[model samples]
Target: MYQQILAPLFGSLGWSAVAAALPLLVLFALLGLVRMTAWKASLIALAVALAIAMFVYPMPVDQALLSATLGAAFGFFPILWIVINAIWIYQMTVTTGHFDVLQRSFSRISGDRRIQAMIIAFCFGALLEALAGFGTPVAITTVMLLALGISPMTSAVVALVANTAPVAYGALASPLVTLASVTELPLADLGAMTGRQTPLLALFVPMVLVGIIDGVRGVRETLPATLTCGITFAVAQFAASNYVSVPLTDIIAALLAAGATVLLMRVWTPRGAEPPTSEPAGSRAEVLRAYAPYLIIIAVFVVAQLGPIADLLDAVTLKFNWPGLDIRDAGGEALSLTEFKFNWLSGAGSLLLIAGLLTIPVIGISARAALGRYAATYRQLAWAIVTVMTVLAIAYVMNTSGQTATLGTWMAATGGLFAFLSPILGWLGVAVTGSDTSSNSLFGALQVTAAEQAGIDPMLAAAANGSGGVLGKMISPQNLAIAAGAVGMAGREGDLFRRVLPFSLGFLLLMCALIALQATPVLSWMTVM
Candidate 1:
């Protein structure tokens, strides 16, 4: 068994941390500055990480390869699985001409681009994030915004930005659940703390989304609606996560915000409303058909996640150690991450496939046509598949080789300053892995350990990890690939990366400050017990 050494570079944690960071620095520099294609950048970064694992961290070469292979397998099965099926379901809607009807229905709500953005990109996008995390919200919403005649870049940015607030509670609070398991903390406490933190993020996202769609003018004209949507979402999110169910937090907030936006649109319309972007509205029956797929998705997920059903679905999942791989950390404890859980039947992607099949009858599409669309989605997402798999491989190499641990350990060595840097760990994790669940898995225990070392509240730091992770979702290479693919702008991921990078950093800074203050008397009351 190969053992990890945290400080493998001349026995210095600081120098080791810098070495550990080279892969990430190379990735962002290539994607954001050099404008290299995503797949190329990912492959190069993967090479860099593997090299570091073998030479710098002095990991066994075979072990690093196995780790990468495991990650690539995971990336394809679950991560790419979700994206492929979601886009296929969408393509089916387009095939049956329901997508146009859906567009008309939104325009009928209010033709103003800003209002449409608030409703579609922020509110509905949150709903998508609630039920289906990962790249689903960004992929689905970017296309919907494109249908609304929004520019490709703006639609991608809005989808990515709006994806933030609901994320920590996303997929029925999966990220927090993971965090709880890793940190050995109470799930409810982590959920409540995250609820408190992200609602503040929820409060301003609609305004940010509107501004992205139409600049200051959009924010000025749609202040009433954005405020209504944002405030309702923030309040409901706070209540549901704190008092209500954590799993249902995003769902509750998203529905309430959507209802509020719809109610406001009935009485108040934004200034400078444009003409309807689609053909005349379809009959009520057609409208219902247009919406049936998404409804079906929610229903399927809810049923699948129920106690008995969820257990049964999970019963079929396969869990086993990766072949020919065994490694312990510096503490001589085996890394449980080396074991893989193949939740094939119960995975979100499988449920989405079920939802798609159920949708075929409701939307009146033939099974054959649906299959054709599925194959087409595969063809469309080919590069996205490569980019995602390679990126996840990079994540795995970094994780298993102790490259990520070195970085975290080095940062934790900062003592009291670690509170301010806590959220950045999560941000960096998610930026690399593209999932808050994965980020928390990577950094949750690290955060708790560091917080205890620094005399900070472990719960606050743990929650901050997830809260900061949401912002990085916007700039993740996998999400960028998904957004670009959805808007038919594939290979322009570099452009999308450049567009969302500033927003990611800006929000991360704010989250850093919030977490830092929460560790002190200033905002300590805002934290949960």
Candidate 2:
């Protein structure tokens, strides 16, 4: 590993860092600038990582293999699990004919297109994100928008934008929980800090999305509903984060916001009546029964995550390091085994499955039809699942192989502006993978390390990564694909990205400023990253 191999490449600390991070930059550029498929770009990034590990960083081949395999596995389980189940639950409704009733009910509540966008894509999505996360909101929200006759591109963008506020507290507070675990920070503090920060944005993203879709008039008309929705979410977020468990914030807040909207719709109609519906009304009890599955899911997840039950369920957990993969410092020394392990039972996947099981009865479809619907759902989502898995695999390969770290280090050394560069790192991770969770996973450690070196609050930097990651969601390849498919622009993926790019970048900058402000020593303790 010396002279001809590691020395020429990883010989200097500076060189090693550059080698780790440059490929990551190139990966994002290829996707953002060129509009390549996520998996395709990921493969290119992975190849670069392999080169670094074998010839530059010179890790043992076995470790590299193990790490890559483990990373891919991590991508599949819980993450894919969540995405697939969401689509399945929705499919059960569609197949049962109850979904049409559900739609009619939603229409009856608030038929104005703009308000529908707010309640479903923005507000309802938050409920799911908080409850189940891992692409569930997007999957559920995107489909709902499409059914409502909202353009697919519009649905995708709104859902992506709407997704922002719930993300930090999403998957029942997974990001905050993960951050605390990784950094040894207090879980409650991390939850409170990120929670307060998210609601501040959550209060506004809905209105912003409305303006983007419907212009100024749309914004004006929906002001009252927006305030009720936004304020409820923000206050709930702040209170929950500061005083309660991270997982519970989105759940309670979403329930409150959704409740407020439902009540408001009953008493206050908008300027125009709802869109006309040809569908017949079903019994309210039947509708309630139809929705029982979701209620059960939430109830089960809460029980599963709480107190003795959660700890007892812990026995089912299986933890082991990903095979062969190892990290190294500038000196080419290997990282400890603690660097790799799949977090399974504690993950959202388990919750999703439990939710799905509970939802099956509520779906109310018979066995034969249920199987048929499941098959059809799979057929419709084949491209999405393939895209998600491949992209994740490549992301893991590139990361575990050490190329991303080298590249971040290189950028850090050359560009000493921590605040400016730090957000960019988070932004790039999101741009590549299109998942905030993935973005945080990729750069969370790096952001903290950079902040410490720069002498800023580590929590602030970690939060910045999450904040910037939201911008990438609008332009990410996976997201673009969903948008294109939703809008019947199947291959026009590039067009969707081009359209949303500006807004994504703009909001991202705004978030970065917010994060920087929150990170100050005086305010830092007030909000955890």
Q: What is the lDDT of residue 397 in candidate 1?
A: 92
In model 2, the Cα lDDT at residue 146 comes to: 79
Q: Estimate each model's TM-score.
A: 0.98, 0.85
Model 2, runs deviating above 4 Å? 1-41, 48-66, 266-268, 272-280, 326-347, 410-416, 432-442, 474-492, 518-529
lDDT of each: 0.90, 0.67
Looking at model 1, residue 62 earns an lDDT score of 93
Please give the distance, in angstroms, between residue 447's alpha carbon in candidate 1 and its true position after superposition.
1.1
lDDT of 1: 0.90
Model 1 TM-score, 2 decimals:
0.98
Which tens-of-lDDT digit does each residue in 339-373 have in candidate 1?
88899999989999999999999999998999999
**Best candidate according to lDDT:** 1
